[model samples]
Structures are given as C-alpha cells and as structure tokens.
Target: MNFPVQQAQGPDRIGQQTAVEQSRAVAEVQAAIYVARQFPRDVGRSRSAMQAACGSMALADKAFYEFPRAGGKVTGSTIHLAKTLAQTWGNIQYGVSEMRRDDEYRQSEMQAWAWDVEANTRHVLTFVVPHAKFVKGKVEALLDLRDIYENNANNGARRLREAIFAVIPDFFIDEAEELCRETLNKGDGKPIEQRVEGAIKVFQQLGINADRLEQKLGRTRDQWSGADIAQLLITHKSLQRREIAVEEAFPQARITGAEITSKNGGGRKQGPPDDDPWAGQPTK
Candidate 1:
C-alpha cells in the first residue's frame, strides 16, 4: 500500500519506461487503491479519499505510463486484496474518463465565447498581417484588450452583450442571444490567486482529492495555470449539468433551488410577490 518514490514537490515523470517500469506502474495503481480503501470513513473529507486514489493513480501514470511502456505481464493481482485493488482502479478509471468527457464538453461549449473575448485583438491587427515588427505591440495590445475583457466579464456583460447583439449576423442572432445571456460574465470567477484557492477547495465538493490533484501537478494552489483553472471550472460545470439532468429525468430526485434555500435559511427569504425585482420585468 506504500506510495511510489516521489520528488519533494511531485512525482518525477520518467519519459520512457521499460517493461519493468510499466509493470510497476500497474502495481502502483493497485497499491493506491489498497491505501485509498482504508479511507472509506472520510465522510467530510471526500477530497482526501480522492487524493489517496487519484494521487496514487496519477503518480503511477506520471512515473511510468506517460510514454510507451515496455511489454510485460501485469504483475500479480490474483490475491484477494489485489483483486479488490484492480476492481477499485477500474471504477476510478471510469470516473476519470467521465471527468475528462465533462471537461471536453464544456471546452467545446465555450469555444465561441473564448473567440469573442479575444477577437478584438485580431480586429486591431487586421492590417498588420505578416509583420514581425508589430509583434511586441500586438502582444501588448492583446494583453490590454484581454484585461479589459476580464474586467467586463467580471463586472458585467453589458459591453460584451451589446457587442454580440450588434456584430453577430442576423441568421445567428437567436442562438447567439441565448449564449450571450448565459456566458461567462457577472462574477463567474475571481482573481487568479483567490480562484486557485477556491478551485482547490472545490475538489472535495466534486469528490476529487485536492491533495491528489496537487500531487499530480507537482505544485501548490497558486501554481495551477490558467488552463488548470479552466479545467476545474469546466469539470465543476459538467458535474452540475449531470446532476441537473438526473434530477429532471427522475421526478423523485427533483431538488428545487427554493426548497434548498428554504431548508438552509440563507437564500432569499420569501415575501409577497409585489416586492420581487422581476415582478416589474415585462414578460415580453
């Protein structure tokens, strides 16, 4: 059940591994499950459970499976404990695939939004095609524009929403309108440092181990890249989507926001309908 040797910061990825190395990696995967199963009592520490499982798996993969492994039999797993480990690993592997699929779905969903955020830079550079001298200026301009986009997306979608309503072709207006209304803006994220901390905290909520993720990346909270943050948010969104879908598909599973709010006693306190802000919003 022991973890594989690791660096002070993280596991050292061996670029190319021999057959022995591959066998050991599989061994480590099983061993991780063995250690992780001992954490079944982690009721409030779901992240810790995930950490033990994923960290082991990630460490094993990082150390030996990143590249083509030498051909060798998957070492012993016929024993009871080994069999259990193998089974747990399969379950965890499937969960990992689900996580990956969720991330990909969200990435594709945001493709157009990302283009919108960065498109102004391209508009400014339209006349500067194939020029190396403008590189520095272009880079700075893009950074400046991106900062502006960040500010707008965080503060409000007013500018971006208006721009979309204006520039989007007539044919796509309906679809684009919905996207504009729902896209990333209106405090979807915080500063990178704060977001990193929030992202780490969210691992437990998502049943992912923060310690395991940290070990996988070989870095602490602040070390996560922009891409990492995107993945975390996307994964979280994916989980939410699945939960919503499940609830909708099954009547018994339905959990309304108002119900949850009422139970928690922290959401908007119900009052007379006349006081509602949306009460004045015309249905049209």
Candidate 2:
C-alpha cells in the first residue's frame, strides 16, 4: 500500500492569496529567529555561528528577492537551510518544511503557526536570545555596510566597513558583556531599543525593512517569562550615550525582548508581524 500525497484545496484563489501572504509574514519572522541563533555576538568563538547567520539572510534574500527575479527557479533549499539552522540553534521552530511543495500559502501558514507556538517557548531559552541578537544585528550591519560600499564607491567608507565586517563575528560575541558594562558606566550610552529602532528605521528608509528579525524578537519575548525588554533599551542607550562602537553594542543586548516587545516594554506592546514573513521552505 502507498500513501497518497496531500494537496491544498483550490476552490478560492482570493483566500489562497491571503493565506499565502500571511504565511510569508510568519516565514519572515522565522528567518529572523534563525539569524539570531546563527550569530551569537556575546560569545568568544562564533565564526561558525556568524557564517550560519549569513546563510539565513542569504536565504531570505533569495526567497523574497532573488527567486522572484530568477523566474521563480532559485529553489527552496535556501529557505529550508534557514529554518533548519534556526531550529538547530535558536530552539524556535515555527513551521519549517524539509519537503518541497507548491502551495506557498501552506508554507506561510505553517510558519505562522510555528511563530505563535515558538513565541511562547521563550522561557525555556531566555539567556540565548541576547547574544544571538547581537550576532544577527552585526550580520545586518555588515550586509548594510557592504551595500553602502558597493553603491557609493567611497574608498574610506569601504575600507572602514570592510575592517568592521572582518572582525565583527568574533569581536562582539567575545566581548559584548564587558563592552556593554563599560559603556553603561559612562552614562552616555544610547539604549538598545533606540539602536534597534534606529537601525530598523534606517533600513526602512533605505527600502529594506527587517520585518522578520523584529518579529522573531517579539515572538521570543512572548514565550519567555524572565525576559526583559528594558535590558535591551538600557544596552542600546549605554552604547549611544558613551559613543560605544557597534562591536560593543551588537553583543550587549539580546534580541529576545527587543525583537518582540515594545521599547523596553515601556509603551504599548506591538501587534503581531503580518507584513511579509518568509522563514523556511522545502526543497523539491
């Protein structure tokens, strides 16, 4: 006897589109979580982790941007690798498929369900989020800097960015805690919330919203009990006020709270991420 393959019902195209859009949002959030896990800036030896983080971002790049450009033939392997890395490192597996399928809506919906469930699992892994967040942010910074360098052709800025990128994955993860402590003592640091918020704003201004990363952070907070958004706010502030380097700020704060909650939970909590999710996809 052979088991029959399952397929999504196709009576409603409109509904299917809506579902697909929603699922994509969840997938984006999961991609962010994977980024966080793959890069832990608060540790000593995390080159491997940094590489993993880059891999996830590359997947996001392919799925949302590259695949569409390539006539939709970039393959789902990128997404699948991203989700696997996130689950393996982040302990946050919001619906990721290893098998390839056609229904984009199903993949997206699975991600959405996983996001809901994983958000509640934060209590089990609060300590890991902060470090992971730093790594993820560094990866973003590096990527952004690369784009800036590529587009502007400024030798000075390119050199600076390249130097920063080269030392990033190792420096922050190794010295984040100490760096944050020093900055905080200076009473001139910018809070983590502000930094993250500023970072997001800048990206959005540049037509690159890091929706998934922010969503994953939010989900982590939802799941964890001891997680504190204030810690992130404080960290970012400490860096800015003290004029601390990104190398320092990147690892000091955890993404767990800031990624998910309001600025230090000071204001109203943010709503769920519904914009453009895209975490894991199966390979056919």
Candidate 3:
C-alpha cells in the first residue's frame, strides 16, 4: 500500500536554499516587517510557528506520491526514508535510501516505539494543551470586570463601554463577543440584562446554541459573569463542545477521560496528530 507523501521540493534544490539565502530572505522580510513594530515583536514567534507546521514523520506506501517542482522525481523509497531520517537523525541526510534499507531501524520494536510516542502526543494535545494558562489569563481578565459592576449596576453599566474598548478590546474567536459587549455597553444600561440578551443574540448569529446560556448561568446574560464567555473561548474547540454541534466532529479514541486527565496531569507534551482537514487546499 502506498501512503500519501508530504510534498517536498527536490532534494537537490534543498541544497540550493542554503543558510545564507534563508538568512537573506528573513532579513529582507524582517526589514519590511520592522516598519510596523508589532511585526518585530512577532518575528521570533512566527518563525517558530512556521517550523512547527512542518514536523517529522509520514505514512508510507505505493498509493502516496508528491511531485517535485522542477520536473525531477521524488522516488517512493526517498519518501519513506525521509520520515525515519527526520525522526532518528533530527535532519535528513542526502543519502537516505541506504538508511531505509538498514534493518536495524526497521525492527518491530522500533516501529512500536515510534507509534507509542505518537499516541501519547495525541493524548496530550486533546486534554492538556487546550487549557493553556495564557488563554485562561486573558479570559480571567475579560470576566474580572464583573466584580467592579457588582457594587453599582448604574455605574457598572455606564463603565462597560470604557472597559470593553479600554481593557478587553480584542476578540478571542470573532466579532460576536465584541457585539455582545457593545450591546451591553449601549443598553438602558443597567443590571446587565441588555448585555446578556445581546450576547445571546450575537452568539446565535455565530452559530453557537446559546438558548440555554442564560439558564445555565442562572441569570440572564446581564447577570452572568464574563467568565462564562471566557470559558467558552478556552473550550470552544473542545471535543465535547464540537461533538455537541455535529456528529463525529472528533476522531474516536480508545483513551478515556480519566486516562487523559491522569496522563495529562503528569505534563507530557505530545500525541499523534489528527488528519489535516485542509490538505493541499486553501480554506477560508
């Protein structure tokens, strides 16, 4: 069976794109980016992101193939060896075909080890990575405003707009949150009812079934803390949340929730990746 291979430039051309050329390219982009100070701030972060998007390992077999750009061919063995080479050596040596034939790396135990690492990685991303402290901090700050408005609904209602634009101005998912914030900001402006109702309306527009949000919080939208919205942001892409919206939204896993909780509690940071929904295609 042939596996779908990752598209790679011809191995020969890989040499052409040298460290000097890469550095020059980055310098040029950085020069233009430095024009906006924000770009400079993200320079290191964006580069790391680009690297993560192209990590090691790939499935092998006859059905898979990726064509090279310069009319040069990428042989099947080259593709297979590339996966092992990427993982074992931390880099792909030019003559990978020899390694592919090496029986030492092809043993059943070696394959099992590779898969064990992959499985644990998937487990980690599913249960742990999503609950990042950085995201939680942002959500906490967004909801913290509820405390201020608690003392005086009148002044609290009046100060919402200032809080929104001045404090939590950026959207976590989309503009719906902002719309909800603006609605509360512009209401008869007291007791938070207008803000809550407006948020439900906006969330509905965003395809979130917010009909029960008020009931869940035990207060109409105005009475609920922004923490509810913040929690939504953190777990918006959660398997359970996505499953509620659509059947089979996530791949079925043998791992149980308690298992994930236990395994994740120990701070492992890896797992096998899910299939890319948008493969070799653009997504809006």
Alpha-carbon deviation at 21 in model 3, angstroms: 4.0
Superior candidate under lDDT, 1 versus 3: 1
RMSD of 2: 24.7
Stretches of candidate 3 exceeding 4 Å from the true structure = 1-191, 206-210, 215-222, 233-284
Better of 1 and 2 by TM-score: 1
lDDT of 3 by residue, 117-181 (tens): 11111101101011111231273222233432332232222232222222211331123233333
RMSD of each: 26.9, 24.7, 26.8
Go through the candidates in order and give the clash count of each.
Answer: 0, 34, 12
* Model 2 regions lying over 4 Å from their true place: 1-188, 191-193, 216-284
If both were scored by TM-score, which would come out higher, candidate 2 or candidate 3?
Answer: 3
lDDT per residue (tens digit) for residues 139-240 in model 1: 332224344444323222222233233332343333322222222221244677776777778766654556545644567766787556554454444345
Provide TM-scores for the models: 0.21, 0.17, 0.20
lDDT of each model, Cα atoms only? 0.35, 0.35, 0.32
Instruction: Supply the TM-score for candidate 3.
Output: 0.20
Prediction 1 global C-alpha lDDT: 0.35
